[model samples]
Target: MKQLNKILLFTVLLGTIYACSTKKDTVISRNYHALTSHFNILFNGEEAFKKGIEGINQGYKDDWFQQLPIEPIVFDDRKIVAPTFKNNSLGAGFGSKKEKTTTTQPAGPFEKAEEKAVKAIQKHGMNINGLERNRKIDDAYLLLGKARYYSQRFVPAVEAFNYVIANYPNANLIAETKIWRAKANIRMDNEEFAIETMKLLLVVTDTLEADLPNDIKEQANTALAMAYVKSDSLQKAKKHLILATRTQENKAQAARNMFVLGQMYANENKKDSAAAVFNKLANFKKAPYKYKIHANIELAKNVVNDSISSSVLSRLEKLIKDRDNRPYLDQLYYQVASLHEKNDSIALAVDYYNRSLRAKNGGDKQKSFTYENLGNLYFKNSEYQFASSYYDSVLNVSTDSLALRIRRVKRKYKNLASLINFENVVATNDSIIRIASLPKNEQESYFKNYIENLKKQDEEAAQLRLNQIAFGANSSSLQTNSKGEWYFYNSQVVSFGKTEFQKIWGKRKLEDNWRWSANASINTRNTDSVNVSKINTRYDLASYLETIPTDKQKIDTLKIDRNQALYELGLIYKEQFKNENLAIRRLERVLSLNPKAELVLPINWHLYQIYNKNGNLEKSNTHKNVILSEYPNTVFAQIIKNPENKIENKEVVNEVEKTYKKLYYLYKKGEFKNVLVNVNDVLPTINNSKLKPKFELLKAYAIGKYLDKETYQRALEFVAINYGSTEEGKKAKEILKQLTKE
Candidate 1:
């Protein structure tokens, strides 16, 4: 009886509201979609789109791009210190480090779109449902689908689009809904399905209104083209790309389109057409990629090399020298350098190489390569010292590239050994002079000052050593989260606690060095030492009796510290930065300080290695032979046996470096896309070498030159390991670290 009464009441209400509802439906359908779809201002994803694009642009670099783009900011987690690039700015970008409550925060475009769609749906959800219910409510569903699509909720977006399609068969927006649905399918890797549906969109062809928007058609075609490209359907890709080009209207956008098409054609060896499109793009000053200036430079090169026409040179100069284009000066300088090299103007080339180096900033990987080329040039000119110097620069920045480094070192070793021999002879002859020149008081004073300096250095060294150990161990735990930066987070609290702990207790570590002693240790510390060797008449002068017995102990401690310092110096000089002379000095100092048994042979081999440079060939071979006879089975001797044998192991890396060099060369030639692949290949093995930081830092710098922040951050992290201790490394670690966080 209740069900019957409800049905009777519902029929009465439906009849009562039918006339009013009919009038409303007609009004709703006529205006909103036909004029202002959704009847409200669209959030449009326009701001985000522009911001993302601008952010990328601000970050977008090719070879010479020099601008600070948006940096990644870590929210909390004080222990995680970020890296910086240059000393130009520090702590300017990241958020505070108060134990980072927001690691994976809710952000990104699609999320906003999805949220807005949901809010809109909630505001007007469902209306009438029967035959009389207006079908135009499907637009909200389309909005939902688009919102989800923007938010990257592809499946849900697809569902919303599907809802509009299935529920509103003859609705005005059926075409728009289908296009959105197809795009979602493309993202899901349902390319074939998307292509099929896009073709279905053709079935609605009548008026332009009856069909999808030209922009929608263009997007659909592009989606299909990319699908073809991804599937390796070159012909289809070209066909679709051409289709897109014809319809693309925005001049800058169209230029971007043409540039990409040209790049694809160039990739496929269709040079003439590629040249044509490049020419077309170069001619268009209105294009937004003016900073790139790539097409202009390349086309000019093609023209200049073919015939050194004044017009081509003028065009090239405009691209190179324009103030707006100065950010890409690395490429410009390199191009000019190449032209000088091509003209057999070696000195001019060297000058240009230096200019290129200066112009490179940190963002150009090709600049490290400038060292190699310049080194080669000097070597060819038989300016061995100059070559060695250039090689040293190359090695310092080119870690992991053993073949090139070894070769340069071999050359430099010859020169260094000759100098060492000269030093040895000079030292032997000058011994008498040194002794005769110094009076007793002066000698004593000299020794005393030397000892004091050594002591100070030792203390500083010990502290640094402790710092390294702390960094490698439980330092993370002691760290507290502060605000904004992860590194600063809770650091004050940690600092306070560390201070309090040190105050209450004495310094107690099993390890030997402990200069960062507690207050108690300081209070109970021994007074000034007395030298028993210099004592006078005994009148309770026992205060001066402490030194004679402890001399051996001090020597042992100094010896140990010196050796450790040598090992660090060796790694730093050899693997970290390739400052061979500094490496050699540190290693030799270890021997002079009489390091233990384990260190002697390695030091000797390294000395031999260092001596093998250009001017010291005889000495290098002498050391090599000495190592061969003495430490035949050691790693150093193994390298000495046949430098040629390592060539194959060097090949993958050789190819990797070669890729960068080639890209740099192409970059010099204004071939940006080729440089892209080179960056990709070399990017994978940036950390593979002892020179990884140098290479990786360069790579990140290169990527930062032409690409986006996200990619630049990625490359910088791999480099951070190599640079953590260095000033550049420190900067790189902080900068790249932040980027990684972002």
Candidate 2:
């Protein structure tokens, strides 16, 4: 009787399960599907969606250098979409090759959430007579839309959102879905449509009607603000952004919205409005740490004036000293540098710029901007070499979007390159000429002193290496060294080592392979028969003297090259750089060198212009009279005679470039002699042309291939000095260095 009762109970349970059919519109079927969809499938789907959003928040980095975007999503073409549920032509368990491939591949959080949503819709959706009885079906569609939106598939995401709105118009989350739809529209760059739709959504869900929840109202306002921002309507954006912040469910987004709104006001020069916005954001307790920090920075920027400069600087300095603000040290340092620069405290500005560069964990864009500022500061101070280095660093890290700024920097760097090259030439040639002119005794004394210095440097370097080795071998020694215990701290041990070293080596040179017996040249076969005492040639005065130029012709050539560099540098300073003092200095040195007839008139004309610009008419007339008297028929004289008369050498410049290209082609084809002949002929005709550098460098390359090493070096040296800042000139300098090594 008990076994019969158990069988009857099992039969009734099976019947009850079978009776809950999805095709039937009974209360049992509807409740079963709704509960399963909501509690099981939709619950997991929502959790996965939240996880995906968390991942995105963790990874997304806002570019603070530019206007921040509304959304934090940055999409890539990495995800492959899987087949949808509606395509049921294939069996429920079967799929095509493409679908199978998609299934086998690992999916990201968004894709996993999307998969769960699709599963809920396909399995639990109770479409009885074309009406979804499962209440959670609308939620599943909303989830699907959100996943697609974040995945950057805006069109498909819109389709999913439209389905939710069309199928379930009275759904509790309809207002939220519309806001998502508008956001997707903004992302697609249809800001006009997004703006209109968002406005309509606001009207439909008006607070006066009591239809919209506070969170939904905030989402709608945020969407509308983003739409306006995208359309370049910052004023309209500010109103909505303000409204959005008042009822914000997401404190982080609200903080960012406020910050962007403040930036817009600052951009428009509405400092008071911007200050009010930033002040509030800075004091917001629930705001993200980054937004709050930047808020304080923006607030300080707004109040930067003569009276408040001290206070502002103190505030930034306090932030810098705080350990919690370590990650933002680069930006803080940059701001301090900018403030010092504005106040004309140039030395402090330079110090702060360097500090910014050395700060840890800085963004590349921040570093680029800092480098550019430092470069500009040095450029203004006439420190071309330092400026060139900083500008080069900026180019290395700066984004390609800054096309105009990059172009301007390149132009300045090119001009500075020339100055650097000529400066190097003057220093090098001056040293050589001065040393070559000294008497033999004085020259010998100079080399002996130089050798002594060289010995000291080498010995110090060798000792440093030895100390490093000793420290590495003994851990205790490293610890002691770190504590300021020098390797020579024990005077007795140091004296013993020094005495022992001198006894065995007899003041041997510290160099590579120094300990080898072969270097000592002692005969191991007959040690007693050979003399142990021998001089190292590197330490001998004659060895150093032999390297100096004794030939008058070579020395003369160097003087000519140095003079030409001075002439070019003068023109660059006066014309390109507009530095009157440097121009005067360089041109005066050229005249003192007794420059060639060809260079004399040009150098004088440049000095005349510089002095004239400086209101030193007496000095200006001196050069003006010289140019008119010495080269009356020249272009310089013509220009001086009539200020309106321009030197239109466009055709000549074009012809010079064409000639250089032909010569370069011949050079590449191994026609070295032809290249040399053409370059020499063309160079004389275009002596004052900017394209002269190209022909000169080509001539050097041809000489390198066809002439002796000494002549090749002389040709290269000429190019290096005459066109130091040019691309061709830099190549010549590089080649010269390699030749010296060889």
Candidate 3:
């Protein structure tokens, strides 16, 4: 009986192995492969794909300040290469600090999913007589294409999708596969082909014998919308977005489409249409919390008017006060500030902008806008110090200097820097003159009070440091030792001692008797018990009084500097800023201070231009006569004599300098495309200008950034050969040598 049972088990095992052979086209073989791919391999692949999508959604931050793209994931233009799955044990580079610590970057979820999809196809796929018998193999190909798409490898993704469409034409997922292929084409910058393919797919689906599912139709519409957006065809994009929203298959996606549609309408100034769309989206219950909140904000902005302003304000305020909307407070506060600004309540708007910045978590782009708004307010009010500080903050937070908004801020900051320097020089000179004119007693009293305030601030800072040291002492992990060793051995205690020493003795050189300030000059009188009176010269009153200009020649020099600063300030305000009132004030002050002979003519010319622009003919003629009669042979007089020759020789020089300055700034900001375009246009016009060599060199640098290395080399050679005598040409020659070595 035992022998018979063993033989029966051996026969059953052999039969099972033969029945499941993949080379055969039997029903058992096909079902076995399909079940293995579907129930096991494909299931795991789809889960990893879902996780990858979630990762992308979590990592990407939407820039609410600009028009949002249809797809949330954006491939970095500078990082378009295929992602590597290998571990970076070498770190950033050899001998770098990062190389000291080994880091391993695991394979991303998309890569794992791709690996699983490949496994499913290679191990379980059944191909007989050039026909795919495994029904689940098409799904595996679709999964492979999706994995590549999310990895930003568009060419590979397109090929995978094409394989399924070409070989598995009658697959159940054929329509979705085609849609993914169209999306990949759009990503590859082939928007025209994507648009045509999407349109054809829609037409074919509509004419099919079977009714197309609404979800499939929704995807097609979404793909077409993304294609149109890529091509900058907003009108066509609006139609597809509207269709996508109406389908409502994916609630979150539909909500996004509706909001984008409203933004498009708002951009085109169709407020009623925009308000309708936003109002519906704002009330969408199934949408994500962020989308719903932002939708409400958009609705309030579009529909707010004199009659409904109060209502809009009430709604925004209500949202802000809600505890559930805490995470969205930054955006809510910013919208409220914009509303107040539109109503001309600038003070209230400023308060709300500050409140927005105080939110626990605010986006960098949002903070930049707030800082820029405050800077503009101060600039309009002629508060140059405040404006300059706020503009500096904007630049610090906004790292993308290539953005148009950042470029504008950078230019304003550069111009403001010159004005600030002039203002500082004038202020310093005026302060010195005023102190010198005062009585000796008054000067002594003023220095004493300043010293007292400085000492008080220092004492408060020292006390704060002591409090921090006490806290550290209680929490320190090190065991305490005897006093002889404790002060030097404990790091925190030693740090505190160094701070105290520096505070009292200031920074001193390591030498014998370093405490004595007069050691180098008076080396013989160095006894410690010789009644040494150590007066810290930094805080001494005599040090302040001795620096004041008391000599007539020195006083005159201060006045001259003050007058020069006022003259330049007048010109900057008049020519660059167009502040006629400020210009007249500053220029007139220069005259009162008795400016030099060379400054007299230029100041008068600027005063004449400003007053004449303001229609004050009486004031204009008074200064104009000074230039015309006193400096008759000057270019200013020549220009006034013949108004038709408005483009004076100096004007040509100024134009070239100004154009070069703008191009240089654009190059610094990495706007190479615009720099190249403007350089090409201006080079043809300024063929005779002395600054022509500078423009040629700038064009070469732009080519290096915006085009290929070979093109850059050719451009540099042109500059080196044509204008070799100029400084720019010499610099270009050096760069060409470096390129050759590379």
Candidate 4:
């Protein structure tokens, strides 16, 4: 029994020692756990950094990578912002170079491993008990900061880099830390801070200790170049980039720097320097600045065709076929088109122009400019009708449609008219030639039916092409009735072109029901605009052809049509469009064209109003004096010479109505601009008169549309403010304001 008790004591003592030994072993293992033990945990980040650099250098095409916006991953919060990376953090087979123990990491990205390292630090940043505490923690934090910085998150990036600086003063990566700190500063748009940090790096460059790696020095200088590029200081960029290109170990990176240097020189118009660099890059057979090959073609365009020979064109043609060259076909085709056009090769130019149009999809703004150029080329060659149609095609996409279309269409119409007449002249000349050459009877037979057939064919084709394009531009929307079938409304998208352009000066008849029922007078504002342009074109063409034709009858016929158009324009401006100045100008041109009696006092009264509105006090007073003095009983002069003496307000309405009755008679007699002025002088006094609003709007329309700039402003403002409730009043306000703003 005593022996059994001793044995129990021995067993209890052995149990206690065994327990202590097990606890110590557990503590040691926990303290010395190798990185290889957590291989999956630490392999992510290192693999990521390596793969990212490779993919970047591989020249990212539209991969899952390039489409993404670059988002940096931050550690403290373990959050990733947009441009989030895609696929795995690193693909399989990373970190194979490192040793593989249990804690030996599986090869993966630096980023993935860094992630593990980060998690470890987050839990133990201040816990200095283990081997991975303090310096290792500091290194992990610095590594984490760099990873975030490379991911393009400047704000969070700045935080990570700043952490390393604050916590790792004696760390081995301190020099790298300083350069990275500068890099972060550059990304933050703090170039001054970056420059200061970089300069300090330079001072440490030739340290007595002979310390940091040359690659780090190279990186620091590269950062300096980037900072300069951001600041738009190309000279500074050139100096530093030159250092990197020469001193850097990486040939591809050096090539990239050279390409940038060339681009900078190209932008500054230093062509020779640019050309040399580009040619060198072009010869670098495996260079990856894919866009650089495109610039060489542009540079070729500036080589000036002093001889305009086959060699230059041949040289250009060769450049387009380079296998690495198809991406910039738009530019290639444009230059070729320009070259062909310069060489007087119209068909070639047109073909290339079309190619250029087709070469790009929606990628370029140059497309519209190219189309307009082709249209103008055809226009200037006097293919007016074709040019006009081409310009219309341009208008479908053009931002400046109104002004451009009018200019094109008016030119087309005038040219078409002239072309028709020129053909007649040609026919007449051909007839004279035939009569001179043939027997008289044969001449008549030869000329008569041939001219007739040709005329009919030309007329049909011209009418068909013009009408189709004009009408095709206007498409309709359908409205369905309760009966169910839809009926199309006549969509009135007017192809007014020259007609509307003419209204800029005024020339249409007062079409019936043209005005909204809100006012007394008929409105032919749009119609009037159309007519005026036609009249002006008619006048111009007829007068232009006078000297070309020797026959008295031809000149006389031309002169008659010319006079008619001028008178029409004058009347259109004075009455239909209501531009007293335009009316006066048209009337004066009519007088110069020597029109028959109808356009005289209309001209004088228009002159009177235009002068008054223009603030030409002398001309206004003089015209009033002339009318009151010479044409004494002329009602217009009397009204102008005596505003206060005239009856006004409600009484003025009756009085002016009577006066305007006589003025309307004058208008009917075609003194429209004069009647407009007379009507205006009395409109203010009888604002409530039914006659007053009509005449006020009419006068405002005339003055605002063509004569006085500010008269439109004043009239619209007054009508809108005083008669805000009336529809005519609102329209007058809109049109008046629009006219004045113009």
Tell me each candidate's TM-score: 0.43, 0.74, 0.73, 0.44
Better by TM-score, candidate 2 or 1? 2
Q: Who wins the TM-score comparison?
A: 2
Error of 1 at 520 (Å): 40
Give the alpha carbon lDDT tens digit for every residue of 1-742 in model 1. 9999999999877754543333345554334332332444234433443444455446644332211111111112333222332221101122222223333533765444444444434333334343324343465566667655654556667767876777677887777788778777766667788777776665446344365667766666666666665566767876766776676655554555566666676766676776677787777767767523777655533433444434555665666666777766776676666666776888777887888788735333566567778877876664445766776776567545656545655556454444344334434434433533566566556555655575478557655654554453345545434453332245654455455444433344555553222211322324675422322122112322322223456545544654655554554555444567666766666667667765566567666766876468876777678678976765456657756322223446666566556656766676655565666565444534544454445555667768877666545543443344445566775675466466
Clashes of each: 54, 2, 0, 37
Model 3: per-residue Cα lDDT over 392-453, one tens digit each: 99999997879998999998998899899999999999999898899999999989899888
Q: Which candidate is the best by lDDT?
A: 3
Whole-model lDDT, candidate 3? Answer: 0.81
Candidate 1 lDDT score at position 29 = 39
Q: How does candidate 1 fare on TM-score?
A: 0.43
* Native-to-model Cα distance after best TM-score fit, residue 99 in candidate 4, in Å: 32
How displaced is residue 348 in candidate 4, in Å?
4.2
Candidate 2 lDDT score at position 586: 89
RMSD, every candidate, angstroms? 22.1, 9.3, 13.6, 20.4
What are the clashing pairs of model 3?
none
What is the per-residue lDDT of model 4 for residues 302-393, given as tens digits with 9 covering 90 to 100?
A: 44444533554676688777655566666667778877887889889889878877874432334655666687787567454466556555
Name the candidate, 3 or 4, with the larger lDDT value. Answer: 3
